[model samples]
Target: MDDVTDRLAQLERDDEELVLDHFDRRDAWELGHRLAHVALERALPVVVDVRTPAGILFHASLPGATADNDEWVNRKSRTALRFEASTALLGTRAEHVGFDFFDQGWLDPADYTVAGGAVPVRVAGVGVVAVATVSGLTSADDHQLVVDALREIMAN
Candidate 1:
């Protein structure tokens, strides 16, 4: 949590700790709105998206955000959901391993990115069922913002 060395550990802990008993459309709505409201309260220009493998349950683009942010949400979410881990974790791991996403050959740049902005939504029994993503801030900031919101959701 203090530096890059700890980022991977923190992200992994987030994946393990931010577990939901269950998730559905209603849960997505609540969590998505929670993220959006926090961004709005802080006057952040961002897009927030929450979606399951079945489909998207909630999506919002705040003022000062654009379609580009939406695309980033898509890519980042895909990366997070693909591995059931946070985008930050993936990116950090890739860097630690000395291979960019392209060298891995398993990802298409258009559909997936290692950027840090998405966190998989894990259910207690169902595993990772969805992802909550944010865009328009720095990658780390975006990832942390989602993590904070998820923590809030878990706390309540």
Candidate 2:
């Protein structure tokens, strides 16, 4: 439990540092490909989706990923965009608040999910401009992959 807490904390920190100075359609396309490449490199079947507040920018379903994974991507991305936090973190928050988010019906489970893999794509001055999401791995792994890729993308 402590380890999980520690990891979530680190993810929060990483999120803070990963904000982009600018993000555009090209960035979204490139980032989506990068995420897909990373998943392929890891031999992980995944679906990647990037979206802005207005609409989706980039979406890809890798080999071995299914329509189910696409659904997960949609729901998880909704969770992140609405909360402006990672979906996994939202799950932890739901636990801390002593509420079963689904049972409470606070959000329509059909449209939103508290599972991991969705990350808000924040801009340094503009707030969350989009979300970079990956589905089909453990929540923690999904979160870490986005964070790792963002770190690399932002650093260069």
State which candidate has the highest lDDT: 1
What shift in Å separates residue 7 of candidate 2 from its native position after superposition? 2.9
Residues 1-156, candidate 1, lDDT per residue (tens digit)? 346668777777777898988888888999999999999999999999999877889999999999999999999988888888898988888777677877767779999998999999888877998999999999999999998988888888
Task: Flag regions of model 1 displaced more than 4 Å.
Answer: none
Which residue pairs clash within candidate 1? none
Q: What is the per-residue lDDT of model 2 for residues 45-118, given as tens digits with 9 covering 90 to 100?
A: 88989998789999988888999999999899988989898888888666655768889677898999988889
RMSD values, in order shown: 1.6, 1.5
lDDT scores in order: 0.89, 0.85
41: Cα error in model 1, Å: 0.7
Question: In each prediction, how many residue pairs overlap at the backbone (N, C-alpha, C within less than 3 A)?
Answer: 0, 0
Instruction: Summing lDDT over every window of 10 consecutive residues in candidate 2, give the lowest-scoring window.
Output: 3-12
